[model samples]
Target: MKMMAMALRRITLSPWQTALTALTIPSTTTTTTTTRPHSTLMSPPVVSLDLPDVWPPNSSHFHFPPPINYSNGHRAAVIDGKLIAEEIRSRIGSEVRRMKESIGKVPGLSVVVVGQRRDSEIYVRNKIKACEQVGIMSTITQLPDDCTEEHVIDAVSSFNVDPSIHGILVQLPLPQHLDEGKILDAVSLEKDVDGFHPLNMGNLAMRGREPLFIPCTPKGCIELLIRSGVEIMGKKAVVIGRSNIVGLPTSLLLQRHHATVSVIHAFTKNPEHLTREADIVITAAGVPNLVRGNWLKPGAVVIDVGTNPVEDPSCEHGYHIVGDVYYEEAVRVVSAITPVPGGVGPMTVAMLLLNTLDSAKRAYEFS
Candidate 1:
């Protein structure tokens, strides 16, 4: 197999080799002297060809481990999303306190949850708890699972007009009976803190135009990479999955940072090949273990956005959340890999609060 691989590599370069050899020729030297007084003779430029005695000769070999060290010694610093999130919330709390003292108004975030999705409920609860921690008023408008589309739209419209509600988020994956798109559209651009509104998405897509809010998960991923001092500019980045909420927007954001981005979707052939060639890989495919160790380049930074719950007989909950990456394999190959439950998930909630605080600051002219 190794011999075949080496043969293929050589065959692929033969055409270029012939072209290069055709352009090379022996050179002869000549001496010339200027007519001006006291001018010295000069030799013609010598173009020497210094070819190695053997092509493809071995000089030195070096091994570079993954950029991130996940050993127990450094595991404590792998990144505590929960702790960092709390720090951000505390900062927001102080800002909120100051805003209330000087402007007499604190930021408020209203969440409209329709139907009963257990996971959605948990997410919403966490968001509310985060709001309370940051001193931001939290309100939840819960509607019945059987509620009509009009009812949901009306709730969103009401929140849109309420000056007290600076940010609004409608829990996703609404009932099958409702139109998710229309309901999300009803949210006013200014208060669409989830940043799903077409207007907001458009603003984010346009060059030189910043959206009032960017989607929490993608923003969090970027923040994680940036905070880690990852080099993004001019690097080859591959984003697996093309969903508007994560993959596509994430690629666009990376592009904004001047990274050459290749978006891979289900139809792409040999997706791993592309990923292995990338310097950075962002996977939001929601499939556990979708990416493996051998598919990564050494020192590559991996951001796993999937939060899939897999049955785990050993776990107390009978299941556990895992990211799209095969963490064990990835940690060995990648320089840094975000864990499933403690990575992007917590960051998402943190960024939501950030967007809320930003909205508040803008609404009250406190910037």
Candidate 2:
């Protein structure tokens, strides 16, 4: 019987035969007994039932195991941008303290705001608060909403040559009359911590030449992606939106990291098809829910840059900030997705402080 069982095990069984054996065998049985044509005595089964399937079998029967859930899995290391920024700021503050002790001068950051847009004001105030907390000298130059482009440019030019000021940032979304391009170009590249200068952009585009400062918001986005361990090298990255502020620089940065990048603008035909094929998607279109759930590939990493405020009467503020990608829809599909308000926004402010600190270090040559 054991010999018969061994012979039966040696012969490859069909799926149906295996199912019949399993169905006929009792779960509590320690061994199987069978009779062969030449032998009547029963013997122990020679093959162990615990053995797994051997290779070179039917190709149609093969299937890959399901992927492990990493989006909500236990992270090996938390990418706390806020904590990292705090550590960087503390280091900067200590260095500033040392510089003051040695050279009798400290780094100063000047913020220029041309309008009273509530959001802009809050951003500027937050920047100033960050500077104060870091012990970096901060100054705010506020101009009326009616201020001409000439007035804004003159203020920037003055800060450009000021020996005491190490960094300068001009709040964005200036009054409609102001030529934002010209104003940004007016700030000296050395002090342009906001990194909107044409020279900085040119250097950023060039190979082997690093920009004096990368734009804060885009820098933050890249930092988040990298620290989260998302693979960038040799992956397809799609950036939606081409604004010089975020999309263009971000695409360049991703290219620097060796990603195959494609930039899709408002006019791009079949944007959803392109996004669906990407391993990574970065949306800065400022259009609410422009990147739908179906546009994302499974396991793709999503970075949402838009912070559009839509009316929400249930909230105390009567509005809620949303990203270009629909959060509810994206989280269900993508491997990882960043929240709108708490995602890239805080990191942007943090990177601004980092740039300011870099400007200070460069100005004073503080080791």
Candidate 3:
């Protein structure tokens, strides 16, 4: 490694740098930061701080630019996702009320689950309950483990044509006998609130094409970053894991927001080197404590999406949920982070509700 000495300012990303490359910024008052280059649209931008551009809490969005200083000064600010999600659900409830008054109906979501996996069952139950809490009508079609593919198709087909059903969700990890892709494809594109449809994903990846719905988890990751006042544009971001469900889409989302994104997966060499350079890090690798404190750029905004259950004899449940990041270590090193259970989890559910609300509005041609 070449040894050099230079002044390093705050490791925060710059919005203007990431927002649009073709447009030029007037040479004026701005804070500048510099970092190593990457193979992407931008060399690490020198961030220009414009504090007024930060969104006030009451504005259309939530933003609190960092370096965020808490009383203690060293530990990362834990993102309160449960609180943010509650705010989103409240907004959705108000919209549902308005739609009911104007159109005589509100949004509805249908969940199709096959077999009786305990984990899936709990997820479905929570989803249905969240729907109720947000004033969205929900239906669950429980099929047996031995159910035929035809039965699954029929259930999806029924929802596809139903006038009041605004969104269709197929609970994941279907029984071994079922054809997952075939079933996912059967859901109508218009009602695919889960956003797993091939067309939707394609729209997400392409410029000038807006997706009807973004996958909930990826969408949630972006939302957390935005809400927490973490800039995406012109920053270097690293995503661990390349699964379609979270990591791939999340990388795409970060790139779309103008961040240079690197995806570190099983095949990636010297993953820690790349990760340590990122201004933002999102890991969904599902390996407990896979990311340690040293694998992060100081002041980097981290959104941990992994929710791996590890054995915990002290706990009554015999296990506990932990994220890919080692929270204790990360807290002392990073600027901000989301806790395992309360972080991305609640946001995922909230986005599902919002997607359903959007689907209903689209269905009725309601603004």
Name the lDDT of candidate 2.
0.78
Colliding residue pairs in candidate 3: 18-233, 18-234
Over all chains combined, what TM-score does candidate 1 have?
Answer: 0.76
lDDT for 224 in candidate 2 is 87
lDDT of 2 by residue, 167-268 (tens): 888999788888889899888888988887888888888889899999888888888888788889999999988888898899988888899999987545
Candidates ranked by lDDT, best first?
Answer: 3, 1, 2
Clashes (backbone N, CA, C under 3 Å), per candidate, total: 2, 1, 2
Q: Per-residue lDDT tens digits of candidate 3, residues 231-287? A: 999999999887777887899888899999999875455577788899999998877
Which one wins on TM-score? 3
TM-score of 3: 0.77
Off by over 4 Å in 3: 1-73, 313-317
* TM-score sort, best first: 3, 1, 2
Q: Write the per-residue lDDT of candidate 1 for residues 79-101, one digit (tens) a residue.
A: 45666667777888899999999
Better structure of 1 and 3 per lDDT? 3
lDDT of 1 at 242: 78
RMSD of 1: 16.9
